[model samples]
Target: MKKLIWLVFACMLALPGYSQESATRGTANNVRQPNVIVVPYAKEGQDVRQLIENNPLVSRAVSKVKEEFGNRGFTTKDFVTLLKASKRNDIISATTGAKSDPVKDVVLESKADISVEVKIFVNKHANGSSEVSLELQAAEAISGESFANASYTSDKFITQDSLKLAERALGKVNDDFFTQLQNGFNEMMEKGRNLNVRIELGPNSGIDPYTEMKTGNDLETELQDWLSNNSYGGNYDINSSDMVIDISMKVPIYDQVSGKPYNVTKVRGPLISFLKGLLTSEEHEPKTKASSGQQIWIVIQ
Candidate 1:
């Protein structure tokens, strides 16, 4: 038994331990069905505190996340390999110094649904057991908005190597993390998909910004009504100058009628249809902005 205990200690020293932290979100629906990408990381100047991305501990932790989320129907993408090939690996070199330009650019270019930024740390105990911890944040690829965050420690009281320790740690809080992710996604849906809208009136367009519609409502009022009826919490921003109207809002990402996910073109489908009918001149279809999820620019001809 002495030899066995010594062996466990040796194993613990050779492998970094992992831990789990509490989650900060709740549950929701149809919001977390996005492709997942896990990015391993360490702190800016605290690289010694945690293993680097290439470390076995980091890789194992990434695997654990993939496995857990995968079992729940989320498709996992190998973002680390891509980052290496593109020399963007440095983007996640450390947690603090994460270079947004390359990392965000790569993320947007890949068109991934979500990015899981992960940092892991381990502490060895004198009692033949080790503690492994994980810090994770889930963000939308397009807007880089974090939807959920959690810190967790392993449930297994006695663990040896970093791989086993990390796996067991993640297992302990896997369900809670999943719930947090779903809740965040649902919240984003409730707040509306982030979008940029532009409405330009043609030189010959008959309707004036201040003119009243046949419904006894002015152009602004009609537009407002159309937007409110179709958006989350009826939220949006509008600015006008000359014949141009620019509106920015969080548009719904799911169809209330069909209960289906909304792509960029479909995000404002109802609103566009309504405006087209109201404005006889012409209205161009909504165009999605680059690196912006569901962000659209619309023009009135």
Candidate 2:
């Protein structure tokens, strides 16, 4: 009478049982995940000095950033409210600019990111000389202001710049003002494109030899052969450095009538723990149990 054969196999690795972990859950190697930093300008008020400051340009720039982030992630807005609360004149420029543009040529300068503000002045330089000077007032002292009209419109960057220049305003470039906005927006978009993450599958599990379970180089050779034959792509990477494999066994069953022999039982167990190191695609460790269930014996032709 031919004996029945039984086999078992499992692909799980054994891990040291520990209590539940807290929010900071990770292996020892995990120091910090990836992160990104973006700065956006939030609106404050719609006054004149505050007017251009809260202008559509600033608002639109910030809006573009949020749209770019989409579902991928979230951003922390660290606006430099310093401008809103502090002195209105040059002091705001000097302290925040890291003294880069000491002359205060920049109306809005961003560093790591501290503040967002807009400048409103009748430049005797851009507009080519204006008969009336409005001084540096944030309020609308005069109606139909050319500079004010130029800045908020779609073509405002150029229109406002021309009006400002016409008034002989030096160091103040209205066209350039919005240009920085464009630059900042571009920078935000560039960063969004660079963020990425990738993952790969490592080694597989297999059976082991008895007494002295198959280990070291001997196991690797056997594993490579099986993987190449069975895998579709016939491509894998095994970590040979300090490689350790899990071992198991297999039993064959044969039919007495046809005199044909084949595998029936494949018992596998003794999960593994990846405590030592990483596993690669080429690396495969033999399983511990492959033929040790109900019927471990069967006719082998």
Question: What lDDT does each candidate get?
Answer: 0.64, 0.27
- Candidate 2 wrongly placed segments (more than 4 Å): 1-37, 40-54, 80-91, 95-301
Per-residue error for 276 in candidate 1, Å, reads 18
Instruction: Give the RMSD in angstroms, all C-alphas superposed, for model 2.
Output: 25.4
Worst 10-residue lDDT window, candidate 1: 18-27
Question: Ten-residue segment with the worst summed lDDT in candidate 2?
Answer: 137-146
RMSD, candidate 1, Å: 16.8
Per-residue lDDT tens digits of candidate 2, residues 1-301?
A: 1222222112111222221231112121112111212222222222223432555443333333333323234332323343444454542333443433321222222121112323333323364432212211111111101111113222223344443432333222244433343344333222211101011113323322111223344435654555454322243344433323332222212222332222222121111222112223224432222232211221101
What TM-score would each prediction reach against the true structure? Answer: 0.52, 0.19
Q: Which number leads on TM-score?
A: 1
